[model samples]
Every structure is written in structure tokens, then in C-alpha cells.
Target chain A: MTTQTKQRRKQALLHRTGSYGKGLLFMLPWLIGFCAFVVIPIGWSIFMSFNKVKIVPGGFKYEWLGLQNFRDAFLKDNNFPVDLITYFQEMLLMVPIIVIFALMISLMLNQRFPGRFIYRALFFLPVIFATGQVLSELFVQGAGEVPFIQQYNLETIVDQYVGPELAKTVMNVLEKVILILWYSGVQILIFIAGFQTISPTIYEAVRIDGASPWDSFWKITLPASIPFISLNVLYTIIDLFTFPQNPILKYIKENMIKVDTGYGYASAMAWIYFGFIFILIAVVLWLFERTMRTRRGRS
Target chain B: MLLSRLRRITFFDFALVLGFTALAAFMSLPIIFILNHAFKPTNELFLFPPRFFVQNPTFSNFEQLFLHATNATVPFSRYVFNSVVVVTMTLVSVIVVSTMAAYVLAKYRFHFKQIILSMITLSLMFAPETVGIPRYLIISGIHLNNTYLGHVLPALASPIAVFMLVGFISQIPNELLEAAKIDGASHVGIFARIVLPLSVPAIATISIFTFQGVWGDVETSTLFMQDETMRTLAFYVNSLLSGLQNSVAAQNVAAAAGLLMFIPNLIIFLLFQRKVLETMIHSGIK
Candidate 1:
């Protein structure tokens, strides 16, 4: 290359970098706040997770435990391993149900109906009052269960069909199905928002092409919403992981404050929880890619 | 689809209406139950297995709650005062700081932009409760502990706010911004005039969620404020849970307090819920 061309390329690079620097001016306030509040604390938490933490005057005294804290969580603790398994099972079942239900509600809301505005608002109303404390309080008062389940002796029948182990999870879901559906408020709203990407003209064209609602749903509506479906899946997973009533989190919190298992053990469990969430996301993303690639090839 | 000429009702319509009403009724159960519990007399509260609704309603529980609040050492009103100041400051800062960053991420071509956005998104998975110890240390270390600033600053690092803002802001037409620039508007001018006004739905959503989260948050109070007077009403309300754990009368009083606390959230939602639907297009998919 000529010297002039090289100089031109260098100038282009410098201009790109300089323009990027302009964005930093707007981001400075957030950077300063995030560093103090998010970055340093997360660093300390990760550091603490490796060492045995002791409470002392004025500061925490740390003893290096390396991977021992992590080991102890699985082998030493009684409830954690069992809780993790059940929690995973619960999430795997719940995420799909919530997302599908949200899609249906959003689709129904998308159609013009009498009192649609009222229904939309009514659907999201649960989110305002659905805090962990209120729900736990309600559960304590025995208001969350499916009353007919016990009245009709369905558990015995469920146990007979599904066997004892899986029956427990199924029965738990049945009892809290209404409560579980409450978690879909945000997801439904997201789907509703996502419909803006698909224009009415396209639907009109499909209708003119002799397409039925079911055909259009499979061909256009579902494809157009694949992007949103993945987004909701991730949101649902993260929300479920951090759910206030999560048994695993409760275990981690209890252990953090307890005398025997300190911050180290608790942090270790939290990291494991993060890992589970990350892996679940990765698998779903891979599935989405594989399906998309096949669809592209077929087309 | 409903823009069709015929105003027709089919079998599917009946099933859909029936299903929607059934689910709506189920969803409203907790709201009804909470309202009923708050009004129930002490005898009704102590009923075995609990009644779904109030049999003998009374206002005595609410009166007792008022008495309890007035009787506290710090007085409930003081906590409310502290929270008002903190919440106002926190909301302003949270919106200003988050939107400024969000605007850049959405519209700018910067190095490591994707990396920065992903990091902010990933932090959503880290619940506030999980980082309690480290946050406590950082707060005390910076000499912000026991101050009102500490109460407000932790919630400043809100990723969801920024995430949603960026998603909504990305939907704004690039040509409009170019036009603004051609008209001699600066970066801040275009944002103030064009971006902020257009993104009201997202702002409404952010404000509603932020208000609800901060209004009921007891984490900051528990970690930072050693003095009772410096804490918030939420802290006081939560403390009531553990303090009067065994008393049946306390349960009635607690239910009343809970209802009173929930009224603000309800009001905030009702205020912004119309725009909240319009805001949800931020699927974070783009």
C-alpha cells in the first residue's frame, strides 16, 4: 500500500475512536455510580466466596478456604443439594408454562375487544402486589392452594399415575398454578410490546392470500415473535432464579447469617446458582439457533 | 382482526370470554384476600385455617396500627419523612444517570459497546440480597453508612432501568436525530426535546417499577442505617413482622399496616399503567 493510503486508514481509525469517546461523556455519571455500587461490591463478594469469612471488630477477617466452601455446599449441607434439584425441576416446568400462557394472553389482548383496556390493566395489576412478603403471608394463611385438590383426594390419584417422586412436583405445581400464572404479567406485556415489530399490512396480505388465522399464526406470527420468545425465556428464567420464595436462596441466606456457615459458603452457593442460570440460558439459545438454521435451510 | 365488517360472536368467543374471566377471578384472589384480612376482627383472624373473606368486619385493626405507629420511638411519620426525601432524590438521579448512559448505548458506535451492554444486562441476575455483605462494607468504607445518601445510592445502580431505556430509545428514528443535528441542536438538546418526550411509556414503566421497589425496600435500611431514626417506614414495617411474630392481635395490626403500605404501590401503578403497556415493546430482543 502507498504511504498516503496507510495515513488515510490511520485517520479513519482515529476518527472512529474519537467519536466513541463522545459517548463516554454521557456515560460518565453512570460509570462512576456503577463502579462504587456494583463493581467493587461484586469484586469483594467474589473474593469472599473463596475464603472463610469471620466477623471481627471494624472489619471482616478472611481465612483462605479455596474450593472447600464450594465442596461443603454439595456434600456437607443437607438441604441444599436436594433443594437445587427440586428448584431446577420447578423452573424447567414453570418457565414454559408461564411463557406460553403469556403469549396467549398477549395474543388475545392484541385482538380488539370490548373492555380490552380494562382487561390489559387488570392483567398487570398482580405485578404491583406480587412481592415476596405478601405472597408468603398469603401462603401462611393457606390462601394459595387449590382447595379442590385435597377435597377430591387428587394427590393419591396423581401418585398412583405419576408415581411418588414426580407426583410431588406435579402436585406442588397444581396447588400454586394460579400463583405461578401471576408471574406472567411482565412477560405478557413484553409480548404485547413486541407486536409493534409486525405490521398490520403483512397480516392483511396474508389474509388476501387465502391464509387462515391458524396458518398465519404458524407461518408469520410465530416466526415474527421468535425473537421475543427467546427474550421472555431468559427473563422468566432470571426472574424465577431470584424469586423471593426460592428455597435455594432462602438456604443460602440462612447459611450466610448463621454461625457455622459464613459468607464464604453462601457466596459459593450463589455462584453455583449463577452457573445454573447461565447454563440454562446457553442451552435455550443453542436450541433457538439450531431451529433457526434449519428453518433458513428449508426456506 | 376485529376490524372486520361483521360484529359477530362465535363459540370460540364465548370460550375465550369464559377463560379470561376465570383467570382474572383467580388472579384477583390475593388482592381480595389481603383486603379481607385487613378488615377482619381479631376473632376472625384467629379462626382455624382462616376464612377467605371477613365475616365480622371492623376498623379496630386500623386504629391499633395508627396507635402502634405513634407509639414507636422514632414515630412512623419520621420514617415516612426520611423516605420521602430519599425517594425523591433517588428517583431523579436514577432516571437522569440511567437515561444518559442508555442514550449513548442505543445510538452510539463505541468500542466494547456490546460488552458493556451485556455486562449491565447480566447484572440483572444478581439479586440485591445476594451482595449484602460486600455492599455493607462498601457503604461503610466510603463513609456513606448511616447517612441518607447511602439509602439512595445503592438503588442508583439499576440495570433494568438502563436496559429498558436503551430498548425504547433504539426504536427512535435515526433520521429524526440527524434532522435535529442539522437544525444545530447539541447532543443534550436533541435528547431533552426529542428522545425524552417520545420515551414517556418507558419512563412511566421505569418510574412505576422504581417507585414500587424503593418504596418497599428494607435492604438499604437494614445494612446501612444503624440508627432507628435514619431508617425508612418499610424497615419499620418489616421489623414489625419479626417483633410481633406470635401475637394474634399483632397479625391484625400487621395486616392493616400491610394494606396501608400497599396503597401507595396500587396508586402508582394506577397512575402509570396506561402507558405501561405501550412501554413493554422493549423486549430487549433488538
Candidate 2:
């Protein structure tokens, strides 16, 4: 090789060595766990999905059973389909309600007001309190018997005496929204964090143009926060799906106890469910990206 | 006319503030409700009208929770201990590993830098629940089931921390690291003495998130630790509720137990609230 070529090759080797050395060293710990726990098992499960797994005295033995698990869950199992539909339906209602309510409270919390910090803490209290046990207990005890509601009931009793059915209807609406409102605290915090990132100068400029608060909110605040909203939507989906009371999770946990069913099939079923969620997330990300681009283009 | 206009703005402000205050109160009522039920006297808790506050409050329930917690049958303390050990181990492991990883990701002009970082970002979409069943089978097959190492080993490499810290560290000027190198500091030396100290804000952020995560996590503990003594606090609290929901007194006692479990998280929040919140706001800004 020419001297220049050799020199260039030497420099490239040094660069590559430094880069790979540092990168691998940094990733080593995570790579160890990931390879052992995540990558290998994921590959194993895919393999196991096509096999009949049997437990013997020594360990698990397997024989090939192509596509049967998938067939059973999809074609034969009636309950899986029912549970899947119900879960999606619940997600549809729950996600929107959480977003809107969280947005409303976050807007309110963003304003300078007395006891704002206390309110913030109070809102965060649900996060501290929403233990698996606590949620189960709250559901069983009924919201009426759940302490602070008892006080609200006293106020409603007075309202009932004054205007009966109208008051009842109003209170009922509040009650219907109560269970969900417990969890919106994190969503509110996230939104407020989003709102605070908006420069005050934007609102000031909008006001100079004689825009109404409503106009400023719609044109400025809402559009500015689309990114945060998308994030909140993703966070909420993950949170709600994993909630202790989520019927599908509860059902799966119940079935795990029976031990007659093989782990291989259960794992395959889980992967199939995960595939749906992956597609949903992809669609949302694509839509968000497109909207963000259009907005930037307009500006 | 000016007075009327001024009065109108003031009125609007007052109405707006009141509406927010009321709404905030409304939002917090359920949590407050849970707290009250958790602490109230047995008879008062069960009255037809229900009690907002106990006429005569008592700690017998809390006492019962603590007393029974260590019993072999309940394994409550064992669960608490397991949670503490696992969470602490995970927190320490993730911090050390992610810091090193993030330092390289931020500082080095490595091959596939963009691809590697983006891959880490993509991993966040795969929720723990989605991967949990396969994880369980793996743990069981490996004979790590019901073992402490089993619980701690799987989560040692948390992607969220790596993503967060990489973002935070990237903001640090490269000039700082170059200065350290000019002083003849080795990469490890610079990281230990310089990078970590300067990265306290990010460290604080990662710590709170990881701590809260491990504290409140119920699912992983449920999946991995089925042995009575191997259960985490979340599992114990869950088991206690179903096992002890018969009487008002027992329910209150269980609630007190639940509240006891919550105290540590509350304390952690109080201690690190400002730093953690600032880091969270900054980390989550994008």
C-alpha cells in the first residue's frame, strides 16, 4: 500500500477501536441481562410456541405442535375473543375520559392560585395510595362508603332538599367520573409540565392581537401541546392496561394458577396481544409525526 | 365605567380561581376518602352513613398490621424486606450501568450511535407486562424462580434510565471532558471524579424514578416471587386485603397495613421532591 493509504488505514483503525471499546464497555451490564433474560427467552418462546411442552421429573420436554396454540386462542377459545373485545372497549372509553379530564384539571392547576401546591400534592396522593390492595378494597367497599365521599354525600343531602332531582343528576355525573378522576393526577402533572414549557411571550403576543382567552387556548396552547398530549396518551394506555383491576390481566393471573395449560401457549397468546398494541402505537406515532410536520410547515 | 370593568376582571379571576380550587378538591376527594377509611375506627367505618373521621381514632389497626406482618403465615415483613433489597439492588445496578452507558452515548462519536440510541428509545414501547410471561418462563426454566437474584437480574439494564441519562448528559459541554483528558485523566478516572459529580442533577432524576418504580411495582413481584417468604410488600398487601376483608375492624387494620407500606414512598418524595421534580420536568420536556 502507498504511505498515504497506510496512514489513513491506521487512523481509521484507531477510531474504530476507541468507538467500539467504549460502546461495548458501557453496554456490557445491560447486554448481559438483556441477552440472558430478554433476547434468549424471546427466541426460546418463539421456538416453544411451535412445540408441545411437557414437564417430566428431569425438566421440560417438548415435541413439535405447529400453530396449534394460535389456532386454539384465535379459533377455538370463545373467552379470549370476548375478553379481547371488552378490553379494547374499556380502553376506548377510559383513554379519552382520562385525557380530557386530565387536560381540564391541568389547565386549572396551571393558574396562579391559593393552595396550588397543596392541590398538587393532593392530586399526587392517588399515585402514592393506588396500591394493588387499596384499589381492590376501594372497589369492594363501594365509593359511597369510601370516607371523603361520605362528606360529599352530606353536601348532596342538603342539595337534594333544596333541588332534589337536578342536584341528584349533577351529583350522579360527578360520581360516574369519580373512579377515573382518581388516576388523572399524573396526567394533570404531565400536562402542567407541558404547559409550563410554553413561553409566556406566545400568550402575550396573542393578547396584543385582541385574541380572547378561548382563541388563545385553541390556537396557541392546544397546538403547542399536541406533542405532550400524544405522550400522555401513550403513558395512559400503558398505565391502564397494567392496572391491577384490568380484567384481562386478572383473568390471565387466575389462569396461571391452574397449571394444566402450558407456559408456551400462554406466552404465544401474550405475543399476539402485544402485536396488536405495537400496531396501535405505530399508527399513533405516524399520525403525530405527520401532524407535527404539517404544523411546522404552516408556521 | 372603569370601576365596572375592573370589577369584571376581578370577578372573573375570582370565579376562575374558585372553579379550579373546587375542581382540584373534587379530584383529590377519592384519595382523601381512601386515607380516611384506612385510619378510622372499626364501628365508625361501617356505620350506615359511613364516617368521614373517626369519633375516636385508634392505632390498634396499625399495631395489628405490624404485629401480624412478620408472621410466617403472612410473610409481610419478608415481602417488605424483599422489596427493599430488590428495589435497592436494581436502583444501584441501573444507575451504575446506565451512567457508564450514557456517558459513552453522549460523549463518543461511535459507529451506529444514532441507531443504538434509537433502538434504546424503541425498547420503551415494549411494556414490562408484554414481555412478562416470557420472562417468567425464562426465570422458571433457569431455576431463578423465588430467588433474589432472579428478581434483580432481569431489570438490571433499564432502558428508560439510559435514554433519560443520555439526554441529560448530552447537554454537558464536550469541552469539560476534553479538559479532564488534558489533565491526563483516564476515561474511568474522569467518569468517577468528574462526570458523575457534574451529573448529579441527572442522577437525582434517575434515582427518584427508579425508586418509585420499584416501590410501587406489584406485577413483577407477583410473577416472580410466589414463595411465601419471597413475596414483595405489594404482593403481601394484595394478599392481606383478600384474606382479611370480612370485618370492618379487620379491613381497617389491613388499610392501616397498606398505609404503613405507603409511608416510605411519601418520605422519599418529601426528601427528594424538589430535585426529582426539576429533573423530571427537564428529562420529560421533549
Candidate that scores best on lDDT:
1
lDDT of 2 by residue, A1-299 (tens): 69999999999998789868877787778767766765666677677767666777867777787888778878987777778765775576677788898898788778876557777766766664564544565666675233454565655675857486355444443454666777676788789889987999999998999999999999989998999889888877767765666666555555433456566566556666667777777887898899999999999
Stretches > 4 Å off in candidate 2: A1-5, A114-125, A128-176, A296-299, B1-9, B69-83, B109-119, B127-147, B216-231, B245-249
CA lDDT of each prediction against the hidden true structure:
0.84, 0.72
Which CAPRI category fits model 1? medium
- Chain B TM-score, structure 2: 0.83
What DockQ, on C-alphas, does every prediction get?
0.60, 0.39
What CA root-mean-square deviation does each model show from the true structure?
A: 3.3, 5.8
Query: Estimated TM-score per prediction?
Result: 0.92, 0.82
lDDT of 2: 0.72
* Ten-residue stretch with the least lDDT total in model 2 chain B: B122-131
lDDT of 2 by residue, B31-147 (tens): 566667677776777788665555676777777787776554755666767888988898888788889988888788766678777767656655455456568777887888788
